[model samples]
Target: MSNLIHFKRDELSFQPYSGQPPERASICRLIGPDASSSMGAGLACFDGCSIEWTVLYDELIVVLEGHFRLRVGERVIEATPGDVIWVPERTPLAYEGDQARVFYALYSVDWQARNA
Candidate 1:
């Protein structure tokens, strides 16, 4: 069994996307991938911004706070606190958020996902 890891917003390692001033932070302490399948729980912070997303893996997103619109191909999803979204691998998506918006996300790759 793994011990629980705790974290607050801003504690994760930030990944800087091209052309966008770093909008993502990786929360390794609280969650991360494993041999069976890697899982992660992290918070994303955004401001009036837009960025292209090509899903790296499967994801389950829960809005912890703030609001935004998810643009995936031809579909648009309105997301707010308590909203939940499922994203498949290789999907294209982008986000436009209000000032200081944050979303709590749960993600895992195919291999690890099966271990659950």
Candidate 2:
């Protein structure tokens, strides 16, 4: 018996991000607390949008398509396909993109509950 999970991008069902306009962003969570207590992973898509956020867990984001940008205060980080960005916990940042897709993995699958 094997306990392995596999997901295809085309088969992912994305939901509108609650904090953003539905037309601007969507997210598909691939792994969470139910799967792993220490880590979480997901895919996000953005269409000419920007999202302000404060991370509760350390995260690594890999750009899959189009252009992606991260604004941490006065510093701006830009990424294209095959690029990776690391964000530490407690960082206040803005995610910006123009038709971009990214894969992200974060420490602490239950960050929301823990932070709350």
Candidate 3:
């Protein structure tokens, strides 16, 4: 038997992202530590909002819908559908978007545990 699993976008259950405004962002964790020991994958939806945080793990973000923006230092990177953004670990950045949906994969599913 194969370990492959398929997920439907419509069936995903999104939860409010911690520390984010309720109306601004939500996330659906598709793959985590239980599925992959070293990586995590998820879908995130964002409204017109900006969130600032420091990443503890390297991340790759693929824009699925609408527009997304990443602000690192004085530079701002923008993405649309079919665009991909790479964020290195320990980078301080601001995530901004308007009606955007993105798929994100990150190294280190245990980042929170390791950082804490």
Candidate 4:
């Protein structure tokens, strides 16, 4: 790629996610490998936030607004603003919050694959 891509808040596009995510969810597309593949920013309801487990290939979650309880395998991670959580491949992870929380993440895989 051309030294990757640069995106300003205003230069980004805001779009809602599909799936059963909270209605409060907002995402900004920063980089997309193609029209069907992407990596972006997301904000969702923490309380109503789905505790749906995810098996990440290589992912990192950085809290920006609030705190949440994170479950990864036998370990529980208490994450708050400024806290960064890293989940490696094959690890089942889930997040819980009393209310909605905002977060930034670096997703290096194809979220469309829906790996179990």
Best by TM-score: 2
Error of 4 at 16 (Å): 5.7
lDDT of 3: 0.91
Off by over 4 Å in 3: none
Over the stretch 1-116, how does candidate 2's per-residue lDDT look in tens digits?
75789897579998887577766898999999999878999999888888899999999999999999999999999899999999999999998888999999999889999988
TM-score of 3: 0.93
Q: How does model 4 fare in lDDT?
A: 0.58
Cα distance off (Å), candidate 2, residue 43: 0.3
Listing every candidate in turn, what is its Cα RMSD in Å to the true structure after a full C-alpha superposition? Answer: 4.8, 1.3, 1.3, 4.3
The C-alpha stretches of model 4 lying farther than 4 A from their native spots are 1-29, 35-45, 99-107, 111-116
Better of 2 and 3 by TM-score: 2
Quote the positional error of residue 61 for candidate 1 in Å.
1.0
Sort by TM-score, top down from the best: 2, 3, 1, 4
lDDT of 3 by residue, 1-116 (tens): 75897998679899888677757988899999888889999999888888898999999999999889999999999899999998999999988888999999999999989998
lDDT of 4 by residue, 7-109 (tens): 6646655555435454534455544446324454444446545465664556666777756777867777887777777777667776666553555554554
Number of backbone collisions per candidate, in order?
4, 0, 0, 2
lDDT of 1 by residue, 1-116 (tens): 76655556455665543456664322232455643255665556566677677767777777666776778988888888878888887688986666434544445534344544
Give the TM-score (vs. native) of candidate 4: 0.60
TM-score of every model versus the real structure: 0.67, 0.94, 0.93, 0.60
* lDDT winner, 1 or 4: 1
Per-residue error (Å), model 4, residue 104 = 4.5
